[model samples]
Target chain A: MNKFGIVMLYSILLFSNQIFGQFNALEKGVFSGSFESISQWYQDDNKIIVSVPQDKWATNNYLSLHYTFGKFYAGLQYEAYMPPLLGYSRKFDGSGVAHKFFSYRGDFMEITVGDFYEQFGSGLIFRAYENRQLGIDNALNGVNIRLKPSDFFSLKLVYGKQRKYFEESNGILRGLDGDLDIIKLFKIQKNIGLQIGASLLSHYELYTGADPLFPPTVNSYSGRLDFNSTRLTLSSEYVFKESDPLDLNYFWYKTGNALLLNAAYASNGLAMNLSLRRLENMDSRSERTATDTELMINFLPANTKQHKYSLANIYPYSAQVMGEIGGQYSVFYKIPTGSLLGGKYGTKLNFNYSVYYGLDTTFLGGTQGFESKYFAYGEELYYQDINFELDKKWSKAFKTVLGYMNQRYNKAQVDGGDYPIVNSDIVFFDFLVKFPKNRSIRTEIQHLSTKDDLKSWVAALIELNINPSWTIYAADMYNYGNAGEKVHYYNVGTSFVKNVHRIEISYSRQRESLMCVGGVCRQVPAFKGLTLNISSSF
Target chain B: MKKVRIILLVVSVLIALGNQSEAQTVLPNVMVESITGQEVSAMNFFNDGKPMIISFWATWCKPCILELDAISDEYDEWREETGVILLAVSIDDERSLASVKTLSAGRDWPFTIYLDKNQDLKRALNVVNVPHTFLLNGKGEIVWQHNSYVPGAEQELYEEILKLTENK
Candidate 1:
């Protein structure tokens, strides 16, 4: 569908809601519509793996419309692929064709049927979602309901089959979840509140594999509790499941569980939070018969910081779901204004640290020394990071901030076994300065070292802002450590803004790797190229 | 083992140190870039502008982009009619910026656009969803805010913008 058609469709959806008596004609009409197109260039040594030509570029277009009436909002999205689209061929379960419809009604109570997305609890068991630009969608064609009778209570139920790309899985997926505030229900005292939740999911699918085994039905359950007081809070969740066999194999069926905990404390100008999680054999596939990265039934959203700066996120850590244990803690504070340490508008400070390790196998006793559900076999120190920052306002137009970060990366876990184990240490420093004339300058520098690979690297970035409408940025990441491939990765970019629209363009030499989010990752390839960006509202 | 323990200890210290702020606090370092590509620190964006209005948005966020587009159509007359400057920023990644240019140029939006590719501005603003808008006074202090967008939501934004810029 074209942009205009999408807008008209949205207009009609809003017109349907106009019966609510909350919008006028102009207010009820199509408010905004947009169409976006993406052209991706890719190349790799593995033709069988990539599936697309190395020398060609592929593209896709998306058009969407949004409409509203009172508290009701609805949206329609159309994504089209004109064959030879990069990644689309291998990614889609069907030929170059895909389309979806989504809508939501009411704030506290919503029902999404057809091809829709949903997340339950922490999404450990079921989460159907889409990142269209990434060509990732695990949307389910199911009946889902959400009900919140009170501020602290929520209940959700879902039953349907997952849409794997353009095709729907044969398995039937069903789930139930409920969340309630113990304190609110009992009308507890001040400075204290408690919340509890539970969830259950079941999947049924018939299977006839090469091994000639019937697909076993799968069952999963989870529970969580949270307690909050005047200055402290504690939250924890535990999940358990009965594992189905791989290809109806009698040897593969195994039970598993996962545990997560979080605690925090806060006071004037200072705050701290801590989290710990241990997962084992927790993979939940919707089809119940599928394996690996296909037919995933759930998503685990990360609670850590999703950095914006390039170097700081160069080795971003994706959450691991297979089996592992990790924890993260963070602190933030501010010096009082006018104090010795708080020169000018008080100095601000922040620090954070996180670490992940392979699980202890001895505790996980399984048959025939076949690892227990709790055991982790990978190398330790999958990924670790430490960061610090300080900010201050010196004068009316002269604010500044300085920050530094140190990170340790394990390529084995981050790269999904594609690359060898790499123990890397990276350090970064950044500065931001505001000019008196409403202009500003932001600069960053970084260095990375590794002994496993003969590569150490350095990077620098500077962005000049001309206030309210324009900015120019330049950056370079150099591989000073590579023995023979010493190359400088450079990027120069600029952006122009007017009202609700912004355009940003850049050129860069790149390296490719999988962009992982905890345990999930997508392969992002490297290339030498120029890129442009344009975005606006209305 | 010792190193792991030390690292854990440091993390504990950091969390302990972080406990001094208000219970529900915003990340101070998070800032959104304005249409002019200027980084508008989340904290400074409000509390300093002339009763500011901040909206959290994304290129893929249709309702949010639409709400702003509708407001921009009358933004000039609203500015001449009222002096409020509506700032709109895109949460689109660097790769999608080109489309924003062609898309916006075709529509000729009346507002300014900033890019928050990394969502720093979003985290600092304590926004979990797009189409979220915050209203602040000239001192940059936030006063009013709303989440999601309805068809006529711009009418409400205009009313608030007019009130903030009124007689300033």
Candidate 2:
């Protein structure tokens, strides 16, 4: 149906809540939904060399509605991208109903038909999900069934075609996952937990190529184990994929495998966590020709800390889906409130270290691809980061946060460039002061020094917040030591939020950068613009 | 042209149907993981007969951490007064899921935390952003909710809780 028809149908269903409400028997049914829109007006600036498209004004809008009555539930999402934002994919150029689903939940089982998202253990082998900010919604359009025959055992079955932009991919996917909780099944009296799960997934696509050696069907299997206690947790997952030729791997018919291990220990005031991962030819996609965040059947998130500061994000790392080896270790501690260093409110500290490297392999230059030892480390370093932060609250109205980070980024491997490795150091200080009558101000200063890439930089921000409703902020980032034209990226914005609604307006000079969320990265083009964001839930 | 006419007709019919339907108050029934990796229904968060707070947060969200830290200071008192329970739901995907326990433990937060690993519960609840909190009454109805957090906003939340208790 067209956009208008879909809107009409949505409005009808929305108002039907009241129609059903009038009937005493159906009055208990409920309706809930949310709406979000982001619009931007682009302006050209010669200094930054921005490329403004024909449509200077762009917006992305989404409206989702859900209804539930006892064991039955249904929902649909409508999305509109008026020519789409500059950085967004070109495929998302129109508006339509992107998702619709219906489901029923019974005592022992639940079944859903239509669009749905699901994930296997740790999402190493199969994951169908969405991230609006990243412009990714790979929900499957088929049947999803969850069967819980017993309290300790559950099984899930899925069969569908993955969503690719506004349409479904040509490939058909089928998956089954079963999980068993030994502790619960045996009714163990100890204060511990143990679970084991296994998954099997297969993808089928027609092969029209002349090469008969290409396999039209690819299958993968994964197994996982999880153990947890009051103060310690351990989990691991291993996946193996059959030899399948695809575009991402240059049509190589090499098998793929991945192994991930995680361990964590936490007590009253101290905690530590460590994670390790290895990937070998693990780029598993639904479509053979899919590229750049399209029709993916698995997830491999980078095992690195996600820094919150803008300066710290300049060198963010993206997980290498093909082959990589890395791990991260972190520790968090809180000083006692009465200690000398803790003063009155106790001090919080965090330390983290992470590193990644290319796989040690010997290229065979053929379909068989390469060979590598299981425990060998590659000679090329992809990325390394070490960071520390301290948070302290001195009094009722004063607080401060200090942090430092050292990073080594390999532009050649991570971003697909041949530039030299960039080494940088960053330090930041943030202070907040609260005034009477629900008023507060926060300020931050950050400096990043580097010998490569764009050289040294500095940034500052100040924000004023007025009680439960309004906030205003202004920030600037300047490349002070640039060998070329020294540029300053500045932004000013304000936001007003009420019960369930929020509206924000901002004007900024956005530099070309990679915006990432949970290791998924997207490149945003440089442009000066005025932007408006509105969101509400009901 | 015909589509516009049909849309108008539907709009009028919707107006006639009215917009007075009650909003959803009870939490959706979705499976989420406990801190110990056990799948628990989101509906099980309902306390027998006490107020409960459901706060959505992430480890990387600074505002969410600030809000939780602010509440942690006086959580014991709030519990003693209104018999309230707080459930912090971390919408951290697999990338940062391993840190939720360590961070919560390190900060000494006195509240039950759950992991919405794949965001099933997050999507069902229509939560578009972090630091979103819902206040439920003794009967498990969402009495009040707010999005975003500013310093001192916890006082306003406490006032809402006080009102709920006073009404009781």
Candidate 3:
């Protein structure tokens, strides 16, 4: 199948060129693509206890090409994972042409055949997407059509099977989404905007199990409304799913539901946002038996703030797919340049608070999963965080950022571990100073203190940036307060970037950690290795 | 047989490259949502026969914020000198999307912002990382692009814009 795909792709390219060559006007086609390679060579480390893979080296490569001519477009992506990286799923052990599609995008309508990624309003009910870092690519292999008949309404239809690694899942999925611009349709107030959207999705698979009451089909629906203006924005979505007896839910036939609400107001130098979400048995997959980010048909992102600092990300939040309730509120403000706190360049301040808890439920054995009251809080706290940051520019060349965070993470609930809830406080200071000839240096010093689980840690990093192309950095993280062995995870790296090409080389001791992108996460195993990354687009 | 297949693939790619015409580097016609919740075509983002900068960034990316902040400090001078317009495209999905408006407004950045909620434009542009920026000429052709951002990188970007305007 892989060979056929490759052959067919090449054939299309060749055939298209020949067919378009007959017309001089159609010869003006655009070809664009990108290539990326991440390779690692591992070495044994005496300070850490980690089981290295037998290969001792691994590389992941991706090459994608896209061609656009007039209103028609086609693209394909080929991926190769030579002895897949440690902690990556074993399913992606080989190489293949993973994605391919052709589509005609007109002003009023679009139609696509083959593979495509799509999402409904906020992706509450259905979303077919990919996150390469998380080893997730659930692009549907089938047909997709989008129609915009008027200025006020648009509709999308999709029917396909979800992609699982290099193969397609057995289940067939069908989805329909429609959106209406209420303000535009009704010619209402010009100062305000309102929109409404709804989605319906269903999955069907053959039943092969022995359970007589098992369902081979599941259906889900979602509705959303959005309001927008120059200063205020509000949106809400609600999803409901029919009974789905899947492995993730312990074969429970109970229905699923979710709700998400967001509101934001922004004005000169001041902005505030609040988001609330509740998820109950909302996990849906094309393959009933699939688990661990595989074959997911919907996306439910964690509402917590995404941290950039290394230490602050140690206990990142992963959304509880089964049942959880959470909300986050954030505020951003800037002091005027002439104010007392603002010096000459003004100061920026940010504050955020987020919390999550498990759902209160009464469990019933067998096909009946559990029952829970609406808007009730559970006794078990999943996660909580409160953080504040201040950024100040003292001079033209000198700037600093100070931040503090307090967090409580329930290890047993988020990650399947038999451990008590861990509470920690983190403080960090970052400084950047510029020099002549476009040379600059940035430094960060951070400390994390806790009484439980890993005790405490201290980390520091310094980076130098050279104009036009070069960046070098070194960092060290020490587990100083650990009761057991004290270890230092150190890293040094340099990168040279020019135009669309970037090459980076690094040597480091990688601590076992969960790397996440946009709320999706994957565990990376500990190893000492020299890493090389090369990427370019043309 | 494997070697033959490899050779065929290489030959086909070379042929495709050879057949490339002098096509203008225009933005993909993908639909993205404006900050005001209106759907707009990315291809229509032009500066009325002036230079434009389209930057792909996320709220969580520290370097992206730093670069934008640095640009904001000099944006007035840049616009006055080169008549260049900046378009900040937020690739934040539903997770950290709400903060985009707040961050931009709070920072008082003088740039038009759009939301690529599903990352259609990001994928089309083949941007693997944030802080990737493209500089387009008056003809809407992508003339210069850079990946990643370091402190003072905006100076180099300004130089590129100067070169574009000088040519004009």
lDDT of 3 by residue, B1-168 (tens): 543554465566556646645333889889998998888998899898889999999999999999999999899999999999999999998899999999999887888999998888988888888889999999899988999998888998999999999986
Q: Candidate 2, residue A273: CA error in Å?
A: 0.3
Docking class of 3: medium
How high is the lDDT of residue A220 in model 3?
94
Model 1, A361-392: lDDT tens per residue?
Answer: 54333422235435343457667777776656
- DockQ of each candidate, alpha-carbon based: 0.03, 0.55, 0.57
Choose 1 or 2, whichever is better by TM-score. 2
The residue pairs that clash in candidate 2, if any, are none
What is candidate 2's TM-score for chain B alone?
0.88
Best by DockQ: 3
Per-residue CA lDDT of model 3 for A1-538, tens digit only, reads 4667877867765664565455435556677777787888988887888767788888777777877788888889977777567777888887778988999999999999999999999988988888887888999999999999999999999999999988999999999999999999998868888999999999999998797877798899999999999999999999999998888988889999999999999997999999999999999998888988899999987789999899998888889988999899999999988889888888999999999999998988778888887798799999999999999989879999999999999988877879999999999999999998889999999999999999999999999997759999999999999999899999999999988789999999988887888998777788998999988776
Taking chain A of model 3 alone, its TM-score versus the true chain A equals: 0.96
Best candidate according to TM-score: 2
Q: How close is candidate 1 to the true structure, as a TM-score?
A: 0.70
Model 2 sits at an interface RMSD, in angstroms, of: 3.5
Model 2, A1-538: lDDT tens digits are: 5757766765566556555565424457777777788989999998899878887998887777777778788888877787688788989987777999999987679899999999999998999999888898999999999999998999999999999888999999999999999998999998899999999999999998898778899999999999999999999999999997888999999999999999999997899999999999888888899998888899887889999998999989999878899899999999989899988888999999999998899998889888777777799899999999999999989999999999999988888877999999999999999999889999999999999999999999999997779999999999999999899999999999998799999999988898999888988889999999988787
